[model samples]
Target: MQPLETRKDYTYGTLEQNQLLENPLEQLSVWLEQASQAGILEPNGMTVCTVRQGRPSSRVVLLRGMDTGLVFYTNYLSRKGTDTATNAFASASFWWAALERQVRVEGQLEKVSSTESDAYFASRPYESQLASAASPQSQAIERPALEQLVMDLRTNYPERVPRPEHWGGYRLVPDYLEFWQGRKARLHDRIVYKFKGGKWKKERLAP
Candidate 1:
């Protein structure tokens, strides 16, 4: 058997010639839209990184929604959830190589209201709702036991499954946002927006 060669050309994309966006959020939205148009699977998927005291951890989660802030859902008692409790600060990043774009955001997280959680929960699939109720997120258990628990819950609750009190949404209100575009000769373009004194200041970063 022959060892596989690892090489690819990235000359197909050019970032310098692309028009610069006026605002960072607008730029991110544009790139996100382009990623979706380019058929990148789960374009809204992002990695949420949080620190528990001094230990850093990260997990991939679907972006349920975002505006001025990035929103995601999870069990409040989960590992990431507990980390947020100890340290409210977090960072999230989105990468879509097909579009040669990435966006990174750092901010403090805050819990959304129960009303918001209720609304989102009501919209989830019935199976997902049941699983959410059955699973003790971030807790350890035997695989078979967990599956049996889910099966038992499904059998017991064939109708409406109420949202667990531990489950909810969190919003990361970004104070810093960076947009990166892959460029030629490894000179990537990086534009950062920092919140300062009731206004946003834009700056270029060394790559």
Candidate 2:
């Protein structure tokens, strides 16, 4: 057996209360834009986590919408959808390693209105729309059958693809948001916002 050894120091930047906006959404938008400007690939990519039967599941999903809350789309019958249905809450995290930064969001999930879902879906690429419409999501299918299904969808909907009823968006209204910045000497900065008493409270945490 062999142990892999690797390490690096992070001194890209620091985070402070004065640098943050009073609203976490504003802060998140700022960081998200910074990552995009910094040329980090897929700056909107995030790991979404859900719990089911007392166990947790996580997967990387691209963030498709954000305003007052974060939005992502998936098949409503997928495993994650089932988990969220039972839990009605989830956590998401974004890590931009090149920027030595990470953001964590924990919140309740809400289905976005159908109109909103359609608007986003309509904006997706033609193939993406076809893929989503063809896939059974988490359901099991034979390899050839799945490939055939996709091909059939492409042939059938060569011009346009309609959004599936099961395929839509979910928004996370975060009550807890954490912004972490890696620092030199292994010391890190952890700033968090907690929604309490109908407002957000800011605090620093040990890392």
Candidate 3:
């Protein structure tokens, strides 16, 4: 690429402290809805980052549930799952570029109840259920072998596919959340909500 210089001002909107909701989770839900309305693809997609042995790994996962906290599903034996098992802390972030908005969440991670996981798994499409049960996530495998596994699963479970014991959902109970909105020039907007003393404390940060 030639000098690789790309520049654009963010004139979309501003994130003021007064515009934020008292409950960060509720505010996040509102933003997520707006992102979907704005036609942004995969509005629920978020970057989930986990640490293992001082090393951090990040990947995009679709947000599945948003009741008490952010929820996503994956194999317990996966890299992210293993990392959370070791550290119990992770961060998830969402960037709606078209909306010039971003949100970051950081907190303790815990596995959701198996019942919840099973319910969500049951709600998934049949192909997704098979894929989750068949593929050994975060592992090396040949394409043909993987296909064979899926085929075998289809043969065995012709009706309702059972959720794998190793696959489930995890919820990140956030203690910290930051909402960002792009502004004119290099000056952006950032508002943080920190859980303190059993209540949420809202504050603004220099951007």
Models 1 onward score TM values of 0.90, 0.95, 0.97
- Model 2, 1-207: lDDT tens digits are 555674788999998977889999888999999999999999999999999989999999889878768999999999999998899889999999989999999999889999999999999999889889999999989989988998999898888898989999999999999999999888999999999999988999998
Q: What are the lDDT figures for the candidates, one per model?
A: 0.85, 0.92, 0.94
Which regions of candidate 2 deviate over 4 angstroms?
1-3
Query: Could you give candidate 3's per-residue lDDT for residues 1-207 as a string of tens digits?
Result: 766686779998888788889999999999999999999999999999999999999999999879879999999999998898889989999999999999999998899999999999999999999999999999999999999999999999987799999999999999999999998887999999999999999998999
TM-score winner between 1 and 3, please give it: 3
Give the best candidate by lDDT.
3
Clash pairs detected, candidate 1: none
Order of models, best TM-score first: 3, 2, 1
| Cα-lDDT of candidate 1 | 0.85
The better candidate by TM-score, 2 or 3, is 3
Q: In candidate 2, which residue pairs clash? A: none
User: Candidates 1 and 2: which is better by lDDT?
Assistant: 2
